[model samples]
Target: MKIAIASGKGGTGKTTLATNLASYLSEEKQIILADLDVEEPNSGLFIRAEKIFQEDRYKMIPGWVENDCTYCGICQEVCNFNAIINLGTHILVYPELCHSCYACSELCPTAALPMQKQKMGVLKHYKKGNIDFVESRLDIGQEQAVPRIAQTLDYINSISDNKEIILLDSPPGTSCPVIEATKDADKVILVTEPTPFGLHDLGLAVETMQKMNKDFTVVLNRFGVGNADVEDYCKKNNIRIIAMIPDSRQVAELYSRGELVYDKVDSFKQSLDSIKHYILGK
Candidate 1:
């Protein structure tokens, strides 16, 4: 079963749940813990993976062949992102705005546009104990994360078939990168808190998953600190509350030291085991 852990907002303990779940299940199963949050990947901080392989993740961008150019505006016209623009005497390619769609190059009348691969990120594979970790680090200042995420998924496919249970730590929010990460997941675990902000964001995340036709459960982190808005929302929507992790000083201290919560909280394992069983049944 492929399960993705995600949240609509940041600081909702999404990574905490994902990392601990992977750690708990690794003892009895062959699992791949994939950190698909390229912007700020922290899964490696919790579970260290021995570096086995590393490679640069690249995305295609438009390259203008000035030598072969007839300054036709076709390339600029075909580019939907405004990545390619034709000035009076020159054709410009903006690498950052470009999505590497190849439409500009393909529609160039004189074939003056070619595509070049730009390094977008780095994909790294590592193994620690029984679990395999696959992570992607987006290049600094890179705006587009979908291509890098696609590269990460490709690495996941190459390493293991769909047979082994995979746990994905997705990026926060309901964006394209988040969608790409959760696209093929069999079940999604939406982690939230018991606050008004958490309730609002959780609704958005739930709607996104429902639109994608994914089965999901909610985990309320820091359950006692805030009001019952999240729980009420879940009940109204008929969403199951799989786990409620109480707010604790120990969890805060462990998180500050970059430690996994399950290492200190023994009872957390039972909730994760139940979630695992629930996912497997689906």
Candidate 2:
């Protein structure tokens, strides 16, 4: 099963849940752990595996060829991302704003638009016994992460068979990045805290998932430290909160030290098993 552990906002313990599940599930299952939170991928920091391979990822952006006669704003008009800007005398193309749909280049009346491969991020591969680890890290100052996340998912899916479980650690927010990361996932684990902001963003994320027709549920983090407002919202929406991780200083310290909670506490592993059972409907 391909499962994406995602959150509506940041600091909701997605990396914590994803890394632990990947580590624990590897004991008996052949799994691929994909960290698609390219903007800030800290899951790799917690994976504790040797790096096997790495590659720089690139995306095609619109490049001016300077062969055109007409200064028409057709390119700018056709481009929805505003990557191509027409100043009447000179048309400027911003690579950062480019989504690389090739619409500006394809529909250019003067055919003066070319393509440039902009370095977006890096893709890394690693392995630890039975588990295969992959992560995408977006370069600083880059706005586009959806493409890199898609490539990461595609890479894992291409190599993995049906028996292998793909666990995706997604970026926070209900944007294109999260959707790209979890679009093809068989299931999605929405991680959230019990605070007001958490509940609000979780609702946005659920609506996004529902619109996409994806199977998803909540994994409540910071259970005791905050109110049960999140639980009430879930129950009202008919959303199932399968598991919860309490707000413990011990767990926090262990996380800060880059140690697995299950290795230090027995109950942590049981909690993971409970999550697994819920996913498998056992």
Candidate 3:
């Protein structure tokens, strides 16, 4: 099964759940954990694995080929992102603003704008025991994350089959990156805190998932710290609450030290067990 661990906002424990859950499950089965947060992949911090492979990932963007042409205004007109602009005598291409839609390049009557590969990120694969971990990080100054995220997902699909469980540590929020990360997932675990802000963002995430027609459930993190509003909201909406990871100083300490808590904390292990049970049962 392909499962994605996601959050509506940052610091809600998506990585905490993803990393630990994958490690715990790898003991009995082969697990593939992919960190799809290309902008800032931190799941690798907790996983100590041997580097299996690493490669540079590139995205296609329109390159302005001055010699090829005509300062036709068509390239600029077809670009919805304003990535290309024609200045009567010259055509400018902004690599950062380009969405790689290829409209400008394909629609250019004079073919002045040509599609070219641009380095956007790097992907690293690691292996330890029965766990295969993949992390893709967007290069600094790269403006778009969806391309990197889509490439990472493509890589994951290329290596994955129907037997192994693939777990995605998706980027936080309900934006394009998160959508790309979770689009193919069989199930999604939306981790959220019990605070008001957490509840609010979780609602947005839930709506996004519902609109996408995805199977998902909630895992409340920092369970004891905030009020019962989150619980009330989930219950009212009839969303399944799979697990509740407690608010504890021990978990905080272990997390701060970059250690996995499933091996150190009993409550944390139980929470992970609950998640595993729910996922496997499905």
Candidate 4:
């Protein structure tokens, strides 16, 4: 089963929940944590990912082959992003503006346009003890994050044997990147705090999940710090509340130092085990 841990806002503990859950569950089941936050993936920090393989992802951008040029304006006319502009004397190709749609190359009447592979990001796999890991790191100053997120998911899908448990640490928000991360998940755990901002964003995230036809539940982090507004809203909407992590100084210090809060053989372990049983039903 694929369980995605997501949030509507950043710093809501998606990685905190995902990494600890994967560590505890890997004891019995083959588990892989896919960090789909291409913009800034941090789950690897806690899990200590040791990469095994890597693949380069690229998009096909158009470039004009000057030797075979006929000064055709068809390429410019077909480009929707203004990627290709043809002046009478010269044709300019802006690599940044290009969407890599290949329309300019196909519409070139003189066959002077060629496709060039532009590096977008690197998708890599890692192993640490019983857990396998996958993450995508987008190039700096790149705007195509959703595609890289998709690429990361695709890597997980291709090598996954179907018997393992997949947990995706999704990007925070209800935007395209989050959608790419949450789609096709068997279940999603929407992590949030108990504040007003948390409740508001959780509503948006819930709407996104409903529209995508995904089954999801809520995990209230830092429980009891804020008022009862979040609980009241969830109760009114009939949303399932899966887990509640209490606000404690010990957990906070551990988290601050990049330690797994529930990885020890203490009461915290029991809490994590209960959540695992709730998720796997075993």
Candidate 5:
């Protein structure tokens, strides 16, 4: 089963649930924990594993070959992203705006535009006993995250078998990165706090998932700190909240110190157990 832990907004405990749940389950079975938040992956901070594999990830972008140029404006006209601009005598290409659709390159009359590899990110595979942790980090100043995220998912899916559980720690929000992260998940656990901000963003996330026709449930973090408005909304909307992690200073301190809290905190462990049960049952 591939379960994706995501959030509508940042700092809602998506990584907390992903790391702890993967750690707890890995004790008995093989688990693949993939941090799909390529922009800023932090699951590696909690998982201390031996590096087993590493590789640079690249994306295809058009590179102008002036030698073969015919001065035709087809390249510029075919580009929907405006990545290529024709200035009568010269052609300009913006790598950041290019979506790698290959339209411009394929349509060039003189083969002046050819697809070339551009470094977008790096992927590292780590192993600790039965758990396999895969992390992909985007290079600095990289504009598009969807490509990196898609590549990371492809890497994880390539290695994972049917029996092993795959946990995707997705990027925060309902944007393209988040969609790419959770597109193939068997189930998505949306983590959120009980505050008004959490409630609002969670609604947006829920709507996105619904529109995608996904099977998802809620995991309420910092359950005791905010009002019960989130609970009321979930109840009215018929959304299943699988777990509620209590608001605890000890948990926060441990998190701040970059430590896992399930083994030390009974409540936290229980919450993880509940999520595990849900996954196993499904």
Candidate 6:
């Protein structure tokens, strides 16, 4: 099963759930944890993986052949992202805004556009204990994470196949990068807290998951932080609360020390085991 742990907003313990779940499952079965949060990946911090390999993740961006150019605005006009702009005599390309779709190059009327590969990020693979950790780190100042995520997912496909389970740690928010990370996932575990903000974002995340036609369940982290608002929202939306991790100062301290929750709390291991059975229909 390809399980993706995601949240609509940041600081919702998505990575906590993903890393711990992989750690727990790895004890009994071979699993690969693919951290698709390329912009701010932190799974490696929690799981001590031995660096096995690394590769550069690249994307195609529009390159102007200045000599072959007819100073036409077609390339700029066709680019919906405003990645390319034609000023009277010069055409500029903004690599940050570019999605690397190559549309500008394809529609260049004068054929002055050529696609050039740009390094966007690095895909690193590591193995610690029994689990395999794969993380993609986007270069600073890089605004495009979808391509990096796609490249990471492709790397996961190339390395993993029909494994007992594959846990994907996705980026926060219901944006393009998040969508790309969660797309085609067999199941998604939405992690949230029991607060008003958590309830609101959970609804948006549920909507996003439904739109993507993915099966998902909610895992309420810091369950007693606020009130029953999260539970109420899930009840109204017909979403199942598979598990809950109560708020604990020790948990917070362990997290800050880069320790997995289940490793810190023995009881949490049972909860994760139950969640695994719930997901596997056991």
In Å, residue 26's CA in model 6 sits off its true spot by 0.5
- The ten-residue window of minimal lDDT in model 2 covers 63-72
Please, what are the lDDT tens digits per residue for candidate 4 over residues 187-207? Answer: 999999999899999999999
Q: Each candidate's lDDT (Cα)?
A: 0.87, 0.87, 0.91, 0.86, 0.93, 0.87
Candidate 6 weakest lDDT stretch, 10 residues: 263-272
Candidate 3 lDDT over residue span 87-176, tens digit each: 988888888988888898888888877799889989999999999999999999988888888888899888887688899999999988
Flag clash pairs in model 3.
Answer: none
Question: Model 1: per-residue lDDT, tens digit, 95-139?
Answer: 999988888888888788889888889988988877899999998
Largest TM-score belongs to which candidate? 5
Residues 58-171, candidate 2: write the lDDT tens digits: 999877776663877789999888878888778898888888889988888778887778788999999998889998898999988888988888788777887888899999
What lDDT is obtained when candidate 3 is compared to the true structure? 0.91
Off by over 4 Å in 1: none
Worst 10 residues of 4 by lDDT: 263-272
What is candidate 6's lDDT per residue for 1-282, written digit by digit as tens?
788999997998988888898888888888899999988899889988799999888888888889888887888888889888889689899988887777788888777888988888899999987788999999998888888888888888888877658899999999898899999689899999988899889889999999998899999888777999889888987898898887888878888999999976866676687788876788
Runs in model 2 lying further than 4 Å from the true structure: 67-73, 86-90
Those runs of model 6 whose alpha carbons end farther than 4 Å from true positions after fitting are none
Q: Comparing 4 and 5 by TM-score, which wins?
A: 5
- Candidate number with greatest lDDT: 5
How many residue pairs clash in model 6? 0
lDDT of 5 by residue, 198-244 (tens): 99999999998998888999999999988999999999999999999
Instruction: After the best TM-score superposition of candidate 5, give how far the Cα of residue 257 lies from its true spot, in angstroms.
Output: 1.2
Off by over 4 Å in 5: none
| Steric collisions counted per model | 0, 0, 0, 0, 0, 0
TM-score of each: 0.96, 0.92, 0.97, 0.93, 0.98, 0.94
